[model samples]
Target: MKAKLRQLFRAVPDTWKTSATIRSLLFIVLGLLIYLPIMSDVLPKTFDLNVNTVSGVTLTAPVTVEDTEATEQARAKAVRDMRPVYARNDAVTVHQLKLVNFVFKKVTDLQGQTETTPDAKLKDLKESSPFALPGDTMPALLAMPAASLTAAAQETNKVVTAVMQKGIDQNVAREEIQQQVNQQLVLADLDSRTRKIVREIAIASIVPNVTIDEEATNALKETVRRSVKPTMIYKGEVLVEKGQYISEQVYHRLDAAGLLERNASYLPFFGLAMCAGFFVLFLAFYLSQAHRDVYWDNSKILLLSSIICLTIIVMKITSMGKGINFFLPGYAVPIALGSMLIAILLDTQLAVICSVLFAFISGIVFNYESLLPVDFRYVLYGFVTGVAGAYSLGKATKRTRILQAGFLVAIINVLTIVALYLLLSSSTGWRDVLNQSVFGILSGMLAAILAIGFLPLFEGIFGILSPMRLIELSNPNQPLMRRLLMETPGTYHHSMMVANLSEAACEAVGADGLLARVGAYYHDVGKMKRPHFFVENQINRDNPHDTLAPGLSKRIIIAHVEDGVKMLKEYNIPKQIIDFAQQHHGTTLLKFFYHKASQLSETPVSEEEYRYPGPKAQTRETAIVGICDSAEAAVRSLASPTPERIEQLVRRIIADRLEDGQFNECDLTMQELERVTKSICETLQGFFHNRIEYPDDKQVAVKQA
Candidate 1:
């Protein structure tokens, strides 16, 4: 039965197994699995209660969690315990004393006015005193003799000054102050008339000298808030005891704690899955429309999917274990590291797309425990920093460029963290701000370090021709490249010229110029095996083909492609470079050997035997390199090549390839071929330009002993 199952699974076709759509489907299913568990509490919950409700079943905490309501209540109590703030108004007491002196002077002047009637003088004194008193009290003030009135005024001023010095506050009412004044007046040694007048003056002089200070009060409340620690409900604690009534408040607490029966809704799970699907579908659409090459290739799809999954897995791991997140938040997951790797290994545009998609994924994955399930602050931080990493490492051809990009990404991450952190909470402490900023910077550097570590693995396993890999292959110190130079020095020089021509042409046609250049460097690696078999390495000025039969010469010439393929496979070179070695000659016939054999043989020769086994050039870069290889050899054999001759040679080479249908498999257009011809001709002209002749004595001479 196990064998049958193994056979059944193996029966699937290789094409289906390597399908990008299947990989995307698997990725979507994995995303749904990751989201479902975290989304349990996010699902909608409805309680079965009108006003009062009884518990249908007992509830218990599934995990240790904080009771938010109770914590808020405790904080509120802490704030309430704080005392109200008050500030003493020294100016109030001084101003009230000054008013008392002014009023007593006015009263004394009225008592001594000789020309005015007592009734008129009493009216004037009442209005000038600025004190609230009965009309009868003002009239009675005239009955006291000047000597008694002066004593009363003096006593009232003394008592008012003393009372005002004690700091009367707004909390004490006017009636209470008046009662205290009346008691003090009764204790004074005076008759009823003088005591009553003094009591009235003393009461009016009293005013509030202390008032509520709003800023100080708010500052105290803030201090209390900051001191209140988080309150939590322990794991497995009793949420509701047996036979306990489920009131509205109790039901809400259970619901908020994710323990209520109504919290089991699956709608949110479905919605979250759909949201994830939307992002995946959007990425698929983007790849299909914008980068058809990446979308169609299964290896690239697998790599992309693997990178996204790896990044998210890392994010999930770093964000695990609740309390530890204070040092490293969800935004510190190093998403930009993945983006930089993708940009270096793949396309920059694809890296940007991955950045946006991962941002959304990060927001959802990290916000599981938050009240709001999607925290867009993390999304913004991840997207901006990831894009910065990708864009900063635009054409990363060296390993150290990744480090440079990491520092740039860290700066952007820190900036984004500061902006979002301040926006979310203006009152955040400098210590917390500094902590999050450190995490942001560390996230960027960690991402770069991880990318550097994992880059070789992806390149080797996938056989990707990244810019760095191409640069490495182009180095003259490489084993194969060095062997080619030592064994076939003439072919090595020819390859360099071809590389220069191909690189210029490919750039003009908007193809992979680096790929073309590197491919040209290794195109003739097979010549290293039998260096003297080809004409270029024949240093003795003797043609080996002259001594051999035409059939043998043709066979020797045609065998280089096969030998090169074997050497490339043995050395584990990427297929992209090997394509140039195999397809550089295409299926074109060796005309010289074929005609020579037909002239010597009794029977006509078959063209198929002299032709190269080829799949043709399968890309624009490969096609251009093949054309340049033939053009450079032909141009070098010219008697006196000038601008016109070089142009004609290049045009003829391209025209021959077009006539022979060598470019049929690739997507090289007629217009692009014209552009390549122009660029190659201009470069060749400059490479073979004339040099100035110097006088024999003026030029530095070397003796060849």
Candidate 2:
């Protein structure tokens, strides 16, 4: 059943492939999926209650909106509360002081006039004064002695100068200025009449030296108004409880938010669509430029899209919960699950990119208040945990590694949660911290569990040869591996040696070393079908191939490729591994059989008949594997092999394959081939290094004597 399904997927038509039309449609569907969850928060929920009427149900804000009435009231209060600014005029103080001096100087001049009567002097004093004085007070100023009058004038100047310097504006009333003058006069040494006269003169002289600065006062009020933030009806915040009366303020907020009317604005939806479109375009651009292999393969693209959609859906579901106690349910969203799976089943670099995308999506999905376009707390948590998950699962070869990756993610999640709480929250308590930590741990563990459960399904459905699957196939206990080990131990040993050589060479040339190693492990599985015919497994037995005719031997030798391919297919192995078994020989001639047939037969033996069916190495991995397979066998056959001989033999094998057009299909460069040659030679030297020969006991005794 699985085999048939695999065949069906392989035979899918070009219409279903990643053409422009299909790609666009897939991206459109992904964008819609993203937009739908976001739209749920913005879509208005209307109420029927009027102001002063009781609400039937508790009404929570669907989206965050400004409470305009409350905001305006707050602004008005801020303006009222602000104190008016004032500016002082030095010229006003200077002129007022001059008038006070003139009044005192005139009083002195009247006292010194001998030609004038007391009435005349009083009249002169009154006429000369800058400000009005009482008729009774003027008579005392006219009769006063020069020294006493001079003290009064000096004291009046002191009082007026002190009061004027303190900046009296229009806000300061006449009575307040009189009270202030009286307080200063308490310390003056003037007689009652003289004090009264000085007080009247000083009060009149002290005009408002400070006036309101209209520009400065207006600017201060503006600053205060701007500082007062608008009152917001936060999303999910209760506007009115069930059976609660709807106040005028509440009604106005509801109406302003479009929750009291049917005609809601579609701008939120349009904005969300734009955001989703941007995310889709970014993903498309990234895949096209950085991971073209996944971009071109429609199946891989589908797999990636499915993972992203599933992860977002999980986050959305988790975010909908009202949180356990003080714990944020967003902490338990398992955001790292998608990244870990992508890292294991796809490219690690692509997984890192998806981690960032998931982080941003999580920010939007988990924004409970909808106050900000994205809640940065969730963004930070998602990014740190996702990156930790991806990096922790680096080249994972064991199923348990996923769990380990999850554990690491959990640790990071806990730290991230604690850090965010400490850094972003104003009043986080111990209970809240503990609850978030627990949820964070649960998120990591859940991500691991989900990734583990989904891995096999993805590999089977999409025929993805993940590192874990490759390692599983490489295990000695696997059925095919066991059969090779027991039935043809010699071939199994040769396969292991080739695996080591190929893995090193492939890695040296920046190819998939794990894939190459796993491929080499199963490359010679067909030899188990005719163990004795192969010289390696013919221990203590006759070489069956030596007894058969050249044509028959050629058929047996060539049959392994077909037989290995058939066995691998029956076992439902991935096509990549199967390619290794099929393409390792790459139509290379069986020289011994072809030469034998040429020498014995009257008719010339055709080279094509002796060669394996040709579909030469079609990838760098296959090409490197084939080269190492030949080099390992050839080097093992050499007697007393040296480093120089090994290097010479490895270079010759690569040169022959290059000249014979075996590597023509693959994109292996001359520089890379040289690296492969060096790597193989180095690996073979390690395998066949000279060892110390210890002397026997009798020889050692003879030498000692």
Candidate 3:
């Protein structure tokens, strides 16, 4: 039972996921809506409008009274206005219809309002009962009403009922004429033709001419089919109820209004909303990434961020098919933004792992719907390309380097795009393929550029110190380290030794050897300001501590650490190195001086006076440095160095560190500590190995120094 409970608990996130849960929920909810348009049948077979060239006061007269040549005359006039609408390059084609988000649904629940007016603007623009509030704006982009819409097309009877009862606006007649002339007919020179038919219609209405009516009816159908729309519609809706006929001229009117666009009649705003949702997710992920401290450092956020990236790619694919993509791109923006910090401040491989997961998750998230094979090569190539660029650029301190690396990645992306395009699609025309190839390479480069540009934002946000930063600091020629080498060569050499030991110990426990090495190099910089006070630089021979009392000697000795921090601050040492320098000694006692103080005093000497003022080690690297520093010093004092003696000394130092609570807050465990001791002993033993004496007896002593 306990094991089961532990397993259940272990499966839970180590950190809270308030934001992740919200985003995941958002993805699932929106995905369902996007996919719903694929299966419904009551959708319109086509979006071609039938009502065109609405003549002056062209009213939907009651069907109860239509037995005359006037109807025939109307049909004739319809033909003349229409021929130009379908004529190629005539500029009078009916395809120039608009489908702006602004809606004007013809449906009214109670049929007619009896007052001719525009539609009510719908707050829910994509709903089945599409309507536009008088004040609301329409979609800016025009839609070609096509055969694909079934859902909204089925509502024609309902639409006709609303139209006949409510008597749609007189202004609608004028707007219809204006839309044709301004949007289509005028440019096609149908301006003159439309006018002629209207004049003839006026003559026919007054005279009741049969031939003219037939010509006019044909003209209207031709004139309104200027636009075409292809739709993915929903199931079972009233496409054209009991009282409608295709020849009733309602299709013409619907097409002109954009309601005739196949599936659009049911969900007018679907595509636009998909695009908008994508933008929303983009912005959300961007804002989420903004909290670098919370998202960049936490492993869960890093993992989930990849998931978010892939989901967006999938959403973009499913939202509008393959038509909307640019070139192959990755979560390079987030991954690169987080990489340097993770590499420099955390761990290199973890950063690499984060990037790897980001690439693969994109495949899972991009849910394609067609039977046609999905081309994931772009995503795959982009991931490989992006991760490569991120790791390459992550080591840099200069912002420009990030961009430079990104540019290179962009080139790789383009190649991948071209190659993948070829493999996925069999079209081999270089003229056609060249553009894609050029674009693909450029896109990859752009992703890198974007990543580079975004790096500073995250760096500043997270306070990340990169590898380049650490390396810049590790240079012995740097001002502070140089000063140490010049003013106190002995202390500098001592630091080198500590760095060697620390680096070895750190490697034993799988910590970054570079950081440990770098930290050890600057750990004793404070001793530089007062070289004579430390034993290493006291070469000319008088011991400064010999002239002083034990307590004063301890004070002087402890003061070096404070002085070093101040000097480092003046020279601007980075905080990590300063931490290692200060914390490595911790509050460890100065046994030699403390014992002297105790021997001389009538009252007992307090341990506080002899201890180094320090914060305990906060990281494994710093704790390893502390142990190594003590062990190195203690080993130097060993009377006869041997493998066992060195091992004993290293163990005692680590044991003492544990006992003193030096590692209380650090993550170093007993197992890791033991490994560190073994490594240090192995290193020291090799360095101080005993050799067999030569029979010549002129053998040199082992190089103990």
Candidate 4:
């Protein structure tokens, strides 16, 4: 049972290839699990409170929340309570004055009629005027002297004009306008009967000149409403005590804060599901667009999913400590750990993307006591710290550099916390600020430590070739490298030269230089099994192939590639290094042995028998390493090696490999190949360049010193 469990754990990731649909569904489900805990508050819960019942349990605000419904209701009431705005219609006042003047002009024109009798003139004045007057009032106006009648008309016009100029709007009542008119006539010189007639004229002419301005009134009310901030229920604030009755206000507050399960709405959960779906789709789109190679590889996908799931689980566990949450911030969780590990194992660009995704996940999972489920403070803290770790480790080629990256992450974490505190927080108490800053710094350091601890496990389980792993393998003190040096010194030197050439060329062509150099170091490990059989290690000038048949020699030569693969697997070496061991020869023929065999055989010799068994180079780095291996070997054999001769040899070897289709599987562009040739030539030329020589006696004296 133990063995079966171990085997199942080892092979499960590989077995996912059985169904693509299942694999995609599994990824989606993993996303849901990672996000579900953060969204649990949104799901429905049961509230066991009756309308007038005593509270069974004390309820407090889980998070700071705004009473949006109540706030909006208050704003609406404020708008309704506001006085309506009004605008003056000067045109209506002007027309009213014109009608009053028209009545006075008709009275004057009727009085000027010489043939008309006093009674007829009075009746004519009434008929001509658009305004109506009392019969007794018109008769009195005609009976009075002309000067007195003119004075009364002038007084009436003055009173009416003054009322119109006061600017009456809809807000001004008709009685107010009439009161002002009556007051003005009380002090007039006109008789009581004449004053009564003028008062009636003035009242009729004064229309309500004030009109309601709906747009202006609404705009003013909206401005006031927006100015009023919503009243918030703060986190940790008391809602209901142990024995307190559950009032309507308390029930509503609980419902708004998402504490009442009976009032719980699934709308928020649906929104959460949609958000999770969006994250999944966005990740897929980003991977397909930016990293097609990783997108297509199921193993990389599995590895990525595992890291995200593990990180989120850790965050959830840390956030679950409600007691600790009072002292330690949710933002203090070590969210940068995943990014640091990923940056070391994968590309920095992918690590940067992982930083953003992890930050978003952190905000959701650590949202306790926050106003919103997505806490921007935690998001900022996570993103800055994660990216800092990745950027710090981007160019680091040693294991100890991980420690330096951790310090960098910690410093950045503290700065981010400080900045967010100043920006997002309303209170700036020194104690809270200093405490948060300390937690942030500790969080960053913890991330670095966690990353360091988890790195080896991830590398081993996933078979990942991290930079640190490559560096470890490249050390000469390793068992394999040391054994090669002790048993086959010449081959070791040759491998070192090949490493230098391949590394330079890979860098020139924008490939993984470290991987190429490390791969070159291990490429010829197969030759160590038969050290004396190969020419380089045969230091005594004795040729082992001379007595043996050409077929036998060829068989011995071909056995090394397979032997190396077995040896590497036995030592549990990563597949990346094993690829170099397997593909360095790349099906090239052993021409010296094959030609010798052709001369001795009676039947025609087949080219297949002399060639090394190969699957060919599967990547640009592997292909370049193979080309460099051949170039270095061929150049070493030149009796009079010069810059021109070395260049020709390197170019010829690459051309032959190209013609033989050894690089066909790999995507090596023509431009990149030319750059590789140039880089290798330059390195070889310098290595073989002229060096000053001294006498043997002088050399012995220097060696003694």
| Candidate topping TM-score | 2
Any runs in candidate 4 off by more than 4 Å, and if so which? 1-23, 41-60, 66-232, 236-253, 368-370, 692-705
Q: Give candidate 2 regions above 4 Å deviation.
A: 1-8, 11-30, 42-58, 73-229, 240-251, 260-263, 546-549, 599-601, 636-648, 688-705
In candidate 1, what are the lDDT values of residues 314-339, reduced to their tens digit? 77777664346475657578888779
Q: Please give the range of 10 consecutive residues that has the lowest summed lDDT in model 3.
A: 92-101
Ranking by TM-score: 2, 4, 1, 3
lDDT per residue as tens, model 2, 1-705: 556667777677746766877877787888877778667655676666688888888777776778887898999998998889889988899998899888778888877788889888887777778887666777877777888788888998899988988998987899999998999999888888788878988888888988878999999998999999999888777777899888887788778767876556778778878878998899889899999888887778888887888888888888778544455777888999999888888888888888887888888777766566677888899998888888989778898989988999999998998888778577787678888899899999999999999888788878899989988998899988888998899999999999999999999989999999999998888887787888788789988777789999999989999899999888788889999999999989999999999998999889999999958999999888898888888988899899999999988888888899998899999999988888998899999998899999999999999
Q: Residue by residue across 153-221, what tens digits does model 3's lDDT show?
A: 322222222222322222346344333323322233223433333222221112111122344555566
- Number of the candidate with higher lDDT, 2 or 3: 2
Error of 4 at 126 (Å): 39
**Candidate closer to the true structure by TM-score (higher is better), 2 or 3:** 2
Which candidate achieves the best lDDT against the true structure?
Answer: 2
Put down candidate 4 lDDT per residue, 479-576, tens digits, no spaces.
98998899989889999999999999999989999999999988888888888888789887698999999999999988988988888767777878
TM-score of each: 0.68, 0.75, 0.51, 0.73
How much RMSD separates candidate 2 from the native structure?
6.7
RMSD of each: 11.5, 6.7, 26.6, 8.1
Q: In angstroms, give how far residue 684 of model 3 lies from its true place.
A: 1.8
